[model samples]
Target: MTRELDLVVVGSLNVDLTAAVRRHPQPGETVSATALSTSAGGKGANQAVAAARLGARTALVGRVGADAHGEDLLTALRADGVETAHTLRDESESTGTALISVASSGENSIIVSAAANARLSPDDIARARPLLASARVVSVVLEVPVETVCAAARAALESGARLALNLSPVVDLPAEVLAAADPLIVNEHEAREILQRNGSQLPDGEVAHAEALRAIGARSAVVTFGARGSAVAEPGRAERVPGVPTEAVDTTGAGDAFAAAVAWRLSRGDSLPEAARWATRVGARSVQHPGAQPSYPTLQQVLDEPGLPV
Candidate 1:
């Protein structure tokens, strides 16, 4: 019997400590915050939560420390109905954390302390092999060791699952691994970094960037253009999908939310552009609230969104 999981996110886990500020502090200057809060975050955990909330059978494969913070993170994942069987607790390091500053304009800056997340070794990936193999889409990010991500991509390919790789934090990847990705997901800036680093001229626009990304390796590519929407590119095709309007309070996990939506929809057999359309709506929904997981919408909510295509 083949066990089927919609998505399995393998990457970092972090506890986000965020502060509300009128504006970001200058390099040598200090700024006062209006409020502060703590939330469960991490590329892996956030993506899995977004998929699970949208009615996907999702799981998280990653590491957290055996601290109280880790316990809270585990609780939060379980609360979101994400399978945590593959999530491990490392007693050696403390839980990962991110220091975040949210500006009034909905933009945010973050500093991450990888802590236990950095300790997600190849062995951890070996242990999660079964879960990875069972998933229809294996979502990977660069928060953990790059080697682990490459290994997961290999596993996804071997298991006949699609690899949805998000090259955030903009690290160089081996061409083989890049080629294995079914859809390489990146924001406009990350796409530029990847393209320019490979001696390819940066594209002038979102759809062009997506096309450039596919040229390097990925079977398809999606480049996010913030509130303007996203562009999808594959062999001989590139198109734009406009973004949905929403009252955005925080943009913290918008990208992760978009990735999650894309992964879930792709796992269910939607085409890349269709998946990105749904992802745009999900990303828009994510910004309407204050935190990452807190802002995620349920499948019904997205389905009921105004102006959804019939």
Candidate 2:
């Protein structure tokens, strides 16, 4: 019998190669980088690690290549206390990789090589059925194949687990999967793009974008504005959750931290607004440091941070 878990993440795992540059170059231009770093990352892995460190019993369902990067990613996930029994190894492809460039202003741009991640099929979701059944919340990110994401959504629905869909790098998805999102999470740009993709009138403001998502198909929705907070919309209510003011040293994994925190808190029975509030703080804290998984703050860390005011 699989034990109950707070969250199960069905997404991609990648090794992130990051470069620090003074500024991002314009197209056809190149800039010299000051430093380079390699880290255990990928939207799925980062969210799973953040959830685990925040005291949730989290499990990851994804595929990694049979390579050194894969080994390192698995080691990092385990060290962070995320269950990886379902993280499979594929021998055909190298691990997924993200080439990221962070500028002095703390903004970043990334290019992804979806190698092994592209190999995660619906069959993988079928194999992880039991783990999905034992989860209170199933969080799905879009770094993997869309078919696999759809399969995970169906499994979450069948298991009666709440679905938290983070629509980053947004793409067209079936309506049923869109409707399954208990709280569809998106950044400001993603929100607008998703709305536009669905043939809805483009919302003029960020808060309206959140409301429009709920109107389309999502049970509820959240549109995040970095450093300014997020807007949340549920069945009958809409609210803005303010952001935590902090100096950002790197903004890389802040959204992943936010998504993880919201999913974890929702599993603990927080309301949409309540969860978004917690997520905002977690995201704010993440940008204060460098890297993705490494920058996440534990629940106690959030509670103890001075001037956060809870």
Candidate 3:
């Protein structure tokens, strides 16, 4: 049976090993952790779950190891309402894992081991072309190989679906890929990298980041500035969309949530500004919880929150 999808995410999936510590340790120094946990995470998996919980018909395309972690990760994704038929199992490598340490201030440091995630190839994407063709929007992150991402993007484009790219871990994208994406999501640091690589001056303020993004060929851009909020820009207009007020517990997966919400809203035919507002609220909600996928809110939670100006 084939199900129509509102959004399809082509990327990585991993088990997250998290420890809450007093502070990040300096080089050659060790810090004691106050709490510890393990959960499912990965930019792609996080976003796919976020979208699915928010009532989007979401499908995930990636690879997982034939290990215990992989089994648990797939179960969690299914529980979150994400379609996992396209997720491949690799016996050659273990499931990917992320080692994360969160400080009391909500800041975090992370190291990722892309085991099975790195094994996702263009052929895998090609096999999922039918699902990609049925989606209203297709989202991709940089965690997967650039070639595979490009293949997915091209497939989405050919299918007349909107292509959304999260320029995470901040890498320079080829001009062709950038042109194919409808809206590119990035943070302040990523904006700086894009501007620097293009030999363009940095935007003076948060709003300027949008213009900088447009100058680089993005049809539209959203630059998130954490507590300060986010900026949304198209060719001629740009504005700061304020974030919802919330006490952050852990900042992990906040950006992925924001990106997912934006794509979901846009898939529903909302204006860019309206979608940015939804994304901002979703991001704020994610920070109030601890783990990545576990912290993400369902659509009802967002709709029921009185703080959001629906």
Candidate 4:
């Protein structure tokens, strides 16, 4: 069948509970939050919404609990123009949730309860074969089981689509898994994790970190460096994409938005450097707002920004 989606995301979905605090409390101390709110989030959901808002035909394949949160998440994705028909509802578990606390400095601490997200099986991925076959690019995150991620990646490769994997949560993923991805995105910390796991220490700098990532199996690696911008590395070259000058209000989903924009651009046949530029713009846009999915920008919003090549 012809591709039905420009991008397909397979991973977790969560209800995010956010609080703004003056500062993070020290050990054994407590602090009061200044504001609180709830929104739909999860790396998978956020990226799917990000791609859809940026004009990609997107589909999400994952599981959520048969609860109000799940219903709300599905509705939100649909409203964002993402296809959720492949999303399954599990009655045995509640929807996943993340408790996020943001400090005045725009730094955040988060605790996630995987809930239904952790229960996703390879069967769920198998059920999404058609959708995977119909996508030009398939993205997966670490929130789901490794087997599920691998299955999705392998399927996408077999179907002649690109496989993009986000090595989030900074865990020790199997080497085979890394080898399967066409392009893998990770933050600076995650790059350190992979190097540490391989019995190596990355030098304390973006340039060094980018070099180490290429030493690993990623055909290409994109490392997001927060305020310092981001670095992109292919087999023979690496370059830093300058970040937009913006005062961040919340940094929670900035990386996810960046990854989504990069994947969207790649699906549209943009080169890695071009995609990284788009991702930087998207990341900058995300921090200007406060929440995860709520903070993502539409294609028009990104295009409206000055100096962006569109």
Q: State model 2's lDDT.
A: 0.92
TM-score of each: 0.98, 0.97, 0.97, 0.97
Q: How many backbone clashes does candidate 2 have?
A: 0
Global fold similarity of model 2 (TM-score) = 0.97
Q: Write the per-residue lDDT of candidate 2 for residues 4-24, one digit (tens) a residue.
A: 999999998999999999999
Give one digit per residue, the lDDT tens place, for model 3 in 1-310.
2337899999999999999998999999999999999999999999999999999999999999999999999999899889999998998999999999999999899999999999899999999999999899999999988889889988988888999999887776778888876788998988898888888989698888887888878888889999878998886678999877889999999999999999999899987788999999999989999989989999899888777867
The C-alpha stretches of model 4 lying farther than 4 A from their native spots are none
lDDT of each: 0.91, 0.92, 0.91, 0.88
**Candidate 3 steric clashes:** 0
> Cα deviation of 229 in candidate 3 (Å)?
1.0
Q: Number of clashes in model 1? A: 0
Residue 274, model 2, lDDT: 88
Q: After superposition, how far is residue 2 of candidate 1 from its true place, in Å?
A: 2.8
Best by lDDT: 2
Question: Which has the better lDDT: candidate 2, or candidate 4?
Answer: 2
Predicted structure 1: lDDT: 0.91
Task: Give the CA lDDT, 0 to 100, for residue 174 in model 4.
Answer: 71
Which digits, one per residue and each the tens of the lDDT, describe model 1 over residues 112-138?
999998988887888788888898899
